[model samples]
Target: MNINKYTKTDLYKIANNLLWTWDFEVRELFKKIDSEKWETTVNNPIKLLDEIDETEVVKLFNDNDFLSLFEKVNHKLDDYLKNKSWYAKNLNTEKDLKIAYFSAEFGLTECIRIYSGGLGVLSGDHLKSASDLGLPLVGVGLLYSNGYFQQKLDKDGWQNEFYIIEDFNKLPIELQLDENKKPIIVKIKIADEIISIQVWKLIIGRIELYLLDTDIKPNSKKNREITETLYGGDIETRI
Candidate 1:
């Protein structure tokens, strides 16, 4: 990724190919995702792109499944970064330094929810901006089965909240096993109830981020879905 000459399309294509490579792995990793998961999640890249663009990134997300996976729009930030020339200017910042940033939403692009909206996309852009400048920041967020909800305007221009659950175990987001072949699991206490958040680590270019999900067992029925609704609901989901 030569930042200097890379257009927005180039970056989008790079991301699209990375995802397509992962599509090959899902077939072998989780042998039996519900047929809907298989078709809806794993088998639909263009659909995901359109979904994100429609709901999050760009407002008009009228993209079709067969459309080019290239990001033809939004060179605004790129132009600014080039003008800043921060990547080349900040040599000292790249000297083995590290920074960690946490956020609830990450719409990486309209094409990828891993980064969601201004907050999330801004988070993603920050990550991108950092990378371009070779800055040391690790963006952190949950590897949600579905990261965020998308609200759309109807003909009436009112809003609707649409839930999109991702099959993280099968997509660009996945877990890495330790030498002992175990997926990392971390436990936390919320409102005096024991909640376990399974950690799924994802490699984002040069950065590494661990995502937490409470949608697994070993948790009480109450805790099993604690993370389902982000930023809302009581943490006292005790059984």
Candidate 2:
């Protein structure tokens, strides 16, 4: 579909940012568009936008009530981004302090489920809390192509595991680019072989989270799959 025509809408703005994750009104706005799609996508606004029909899009655009709510939520997000927070007001120093937090997985939202358990949840919460607090913090984590496994049950009540490969293009993340407009890649030697890593950026409110990925053409098949799964494979994969 030609989504460019709708890019100027506030819906796209809200969908691209994780701020909608915490903003109830934004979530409600999305649900207002299509409740079934919202639930099926696990409250993912990006996917919802893609699935919504053009007729619905046109109808919503012409809707006065929808426009009013969109304006309200958009303004709120604007104010949040432009206004100074506690850290900015109280901490006045010549040099700005920045912190980098590293974790194996981050459970930011259900749609972007790279997290496996409590640790991922805690890490995700930390990033959200940091964003809310207006701290100059950056999160570092791995971008698993398949992320975690989805649970299923057989007719006999047996448990089954399935991995869903995520399309990063559909997700709320941007690839890091260099001055040449090429993807910014870093290389590091792991044992006898050198691994090339591509960087992806995930924005959380005012905070920035950088995710590392080994899934690229420069790397070998085995190395490319290094970031394919979360908490999967042997200890060698963990490294």
Q: Which candidate is the best by lDDT?
A: 2
- RMSD of candidate 2 to the truth, in angstroms, is 3.1
What candidate 2 gets wrong by more than 4 Å, as runs, is 1-9
Worst window of 10 by summed lDDT in candidate 2: 1-10
Lowest lDDT sum, 10 consecutive residues, model 1, at 65-74
- TM-scores, each model vs. reference: 0.54, 0.93
Tens digits of lDDT, candidate 2, 107-171: 89999978999999999999888888888899999999999999999999999999999999888
C-alpha root-mean-square deviation, each candidate:
11.9, 3.1
Residue-level lDDT for 73 in candidate 2 = 82
